[model samples]
Target chain A: MKLGRLNHVGVATPSIADSITLYRETMGAVAIGEPFDLPAQGVKVCFVDTPNAQIELIEPLGDASPIHGFLAKNPGGGQHHLCYEVPDINEAKAWFEAKGARVLGEPRIGAHGTMIFFVHPKDMGGVLTEIMETPKDGH
Target chain B: MKLGRLNHVGVATPSIADSITLYRETMGAVAIGEPFDLPAQGVKVCFVDTPNAQIELIEPLGDASPIHGFLAKNPGGGQHHLCYEVPDINEAKAWFEAKGARVLGEPRIGAHGTMIFFVHPKDMGGVLTEIMETPKDGH
Candidate 1:
């Protein structure tokens, strides 16, 4: 896979508000974005813009949300996955699949409104990996 | 604290050889550096250079290595910490302390042969962050 750039890191948190505070008041991150709900992904998301990359703060949308299990294991929440930009999603998918890695699902609209899919953790050196297509015309 | 850039992502691995295989053979990563031992840190390390940043693969050097605990929890190993370059280690330390965040210890020699310290995950949005002074020269 031709991983373009590390776009952002996914961080699972119990509360986006507290996470935002930690990133802002503590880390002095001034470019935090407004929290938004992503019902399809079963989580609320916020993008903390950094000079070189972004940090995606994820909070479980409901009790049944997939993130709930991760939060249960790590109550304080933790780093979820590392997402990298790819020039062509389909090419990356084909390459990863050919390498015997499992592509979790077909390319779907991600929080950034770009096509994205997750590669299984076991296939990605124990790190759940997200391959995202570069955002078109937007920062 | 003024974060410079994402230096490298530290990934705990059962075997750097296997991890290297994944990055090179599978992920099409080039410029993989030879593995070396960092006895002081109790880990064998390898730096896989990427276009934007590097991936540090860490394996236990001995039975008492700290990574053994993490590897035990995650048999296949997992992502450990995100390391970012800082212009001045001391200034960054003071800034983090003033923010009421815990700086692990005094600056010490890191894998890149630069002064580095870890910020407590509790204060870092549940992510163990490593702050390293920029290396004088490229790795």
Candidate 2:
């Protein structure tokens, strides 16, 4: 259950376009990826590459999007979650459960196409935490 | 003004000890640092070093602490801010200002003892962003 690198910080935004502009024009970020919709997740995501990690910008894709409530409370967008890589997703889930920490759901394929599961924020010091299996190629 | 690295992600918590336990015991993190109080910042801080970046846990030090209001809103604590390193502090500040982004204050000594300033969340797509000068030693 050893925690790996801090994979990415998920930022929920109202508009990925505007977020891209802020990161590129204002923050002088040059390695931002193009925004793409994840219909299954009901959101659009863009990656802003940093030397150490990436900033994941997410925007709701429809009314029933999972992050709609969050955006309702934070219309301007906000830090949504923190994703940390682990050697094994199942092992991580078992460790969290053993400690009485609530895992949000069964491990499923995440945005990066790796097995991932979320721990309830209440059990994670009020931070939505995602445990992601390290990519097979170690990207 | 090029973004250097994902310096650290600041997490606000009610108790640094509890957060430390979560990271060490539950998350299986072994690089947790001792917690210390920063009277000037009115917060107690601890650094949980990950392979790529660090997680800075901050707890209010007094009633007058700046993060008191945030904690009141999110009593369980939450992700407070994201910090990125820049080549120069003053140059980064001017770059943000010129782009019509509001800098919270003049560059000052931050927890890492490096010159840093914060940009208003409204201008950063709802994320509190800290711009720090690359440490002289580049730790």
Candidate 3:
């Protein structure tokens, strides 16, 4: 149950374009590609590559996305979660469960081909946290 | 104008003690120190050290702190900001100001002899971003 380096930073915004400008022009992160819609998460997202890692900016496409609810209430900005790289998702989940922390979902595939799991906010005070293991080489 | 590696992740919580437990016992992070009260910020905080950086869990003393407002509005969860390490606070401020980004405050002393500045949320589309520089040794 060791936490690895940060995997990515999740940011919620009304528009991904503005986020790209801010992170790109102000922070000098390299834009990886055009924004893409993830219907499963109900978000349209773009990734920025930093010297060390990446930043993810997401906008909700419809009411079905949780991000849509976040934007509806907050409108402008929100920080989603801090994702930490883990070596083993199942082992981490088992450790959290044994320690009285509730797991929000079973380990599942996430962006960057990593296996990820979320820990409930109640257990984390008020921050949603995710643990992931980078995809093995060659899938 | 480049985002650096993440310096730290800020988590808003009701109890730093409980948050520390989960981060340490489950995630293999070591607590940096006992929770410390930030009177000016109206909160108490503790740090968990990871391989690359640290995570800060903030517990508001009352309704005056920003964390308090964040928790009131979204009791479920919230992330404060992703702080980036910079080499020169003044240069970073100047560079971003030239780009029309709103600088929240002048460089101020931060934890561990660091100089830090915040970019206003309005300028960055709701993310209260920050730039920080480690003070020169023996300065």
Candidate 4:
């Protein structure tokens, strides 16, 4: 289970528009992607590409969204999770389970249209972590 | 200001030894650096190098260390901060200041023996951020 390269850092936000401005004006970040809704995930997402990684800005889509609660606690929003790429999602899942780390769910399609699964925070120190399978060519 | 590559993500741990085992045995990590004391920072530090970035395990060295407070709040340890490299520390500081982001203090020698400073979490979307000047050749 070779830990892979970082795919992106998830940043929950009250409003992606306002957060985009913060990244652009304050952080000098360019190449911001258009926002798109992910109803399954119950959030709207956008990618702000940086030098070495992407900053994924996410805003709750509705009342049932998990991000809604995070936003309630932090109106301005904050870092949600760190995602690392894995070559094979199944192999990664098996490895974590064998090591007694709790895998939150079975593999599912993630934001990038790639297989992904979250590891339980309690088992992963305290930080919520996402493991994503790298997208294949021409996806 | 160009955001250089991500240097490391700081993880506050109650025990570096336990965290190291989690990474080594659970995550299949093999190249963790030896733990070292950073007396000035009041923390014991170790780097779990990954393909693209690093996981910095930081344990409070004494009660005087700020990490002790973080640990008190989160006994299980958690993500503390995200550190990014900057080409010029002074320029980055000035830019953040101009943008109304709070710079915690004057540049000081960081654990890596390079100039670094913390940005207030409130101003950084609730994530403590560290801006470090890349170390010169051979430190």
Best candidate, TM-score-wise?
A: 2
Ranking by DockQ: 2, 4, 1, 3
Look at candidate 2 and give me any clashing residue pairs: none
> Considering lDDT, which of the candidate structures 3 and 4 is the better prediction for this target?
4
In lDDT terms, which candidate is top? 2
lDDT of 4 by residue, B1-139 (tens): 8556778889999999999998888777778999999888899999997777788999999779989998887899988988888889999999999999999979988878899999998887777899999878732
lDDT of 2 by residue, A8-98 (tens): 9999998898888888889888899988888877889999999889999999998889999999999999999999999888888888999
Residue pairs clashing, model 4: none
List, for all models, the DockQ compared with the true complex: 0.61, 0.88, 0.57, 0.68
TM-scores vs. true structure, each candidate: 0.94, 0.97, 0.86, 0.94
Each model's C-alpha lDDT?
Answer: 0.87, 0.91, 0.74, 0.86
Q: List where candidate 3 sits over 4 angstroms from the true fold.
A: A61-63, A137-139, B37-43, B61-66, B74-77, B135-139
Model 4, residue B88: displacement in angstroms?
1.0
Candidate 1 TM-score, true structure as reference:
0.94
Q: Which stretches of candidate 4 lie over 4 Å from their true place?
A: none
- Which candidate has the highest DockQ of all? 2
Share of native interface contacts recovered by each model: 0.52, 0.89, 0.70, 0.66
Of the pair 3 and 4, which is ahead by DockQ? 4
Model 2 reaches what TM-score against the true structure?
A: 0.97
